[model samples]
Target: MDTILYPLEWFVAFVMVGFHKIFSTIGLNAESGWTWALSIVGLVVVLRILLIPLFVKQIKSSRRLQLIQPEMQKIQAKYKGKKILSPARSRPRK
Candidate 1:
């Protein structure tokens, strides 16, 4: 949890700073609701850009899984097992 604080702060600060700069350039106050709205848009665009590669990788992964679907189904059909048994362990009473 502690490790996540820096990234969270960085993202928030990034959006705020971006908003401030844009607002300053456009002669709008940083505290305006419109400024905040555009800042959120800026954040969304930045995040989308950053995640593009990950999204592409995920798409590729899904395609690979799709390709394997037939084989997986065949394996499941072969297994068509009723139930799986596992060794049970006793828990101590409090």
Candidate 2:
């Protein structure tokens, strides 16, 4: 488990440090606790910005699925109680 998470840990640290550098360059104190806290917040904001497209796609997909739900239900109802013969059952009797 630690092995799998090692890369992610590195990535998170890299993002935080990058944000810290940016903040420090912007005249924020390099040693202040608030600077570090803002770095963490910056990381969260960056991650959310990166995920916006994925979130939009997921919402669109959900809406499309919802629109087709009635059709899916109708199909399910049409097939309800109908016997679905398997390959083994469909074979001619010996």
Candidate 3:
């Protein structure tokens, strides 16, 4: 995962540098390192905002699965030692 992420990190750094250069050209106080820092922070803020909905959906789905876990376990126990498609046989059919 680190191998896959390294390039992505580099790409983000490159974009931030490019953005800093553009801001400098526009005379937006980009001469200071703070401009690059703020750009990266802004990017993080935007990404977090975008992921909020996805995070909420994941939490809801996880809660629903938790609610169904007991019923799923009961089902497993009820079918224990029984052939799923052959109720009259003890061994599984070939």
Top lDDT prediction, candidate number: 2
What are the per-residue Cα lDDT tens digits for candidate 3 across 1-94? 9998999788677767777777778787966877888777766876688889999999999999999999999999998998665565857768
Of the candidates numbered 1 and 2, which has the greater TM-score value? 2
What residue runs in model 3 are displaced by over 4 Å at the alpha carbon? 1-28, 81-94
lDDT of 2 at 88: 95
What is the number of backbone collisions in each predicted candidate, taken in the order shown?
0, 0, 0
How close to the true structure is residue 19 of candidate 2, measured as C-alpha lDDT? 92
Per-residue CA lDDT of candidate 2, range 22-73, in tens? 9999999999998999999998998899999999999999999999999999
lDDT of each candidate versus the true structure = 0.82, 0.96, 0.82
- Give a tens-digit lDDT track for model 1, residues 10-94: 8778776877688768987766788777877888888899999999999999999999999999989987975655455344447
- The TM-score of predicted model 1 comes to 0.72
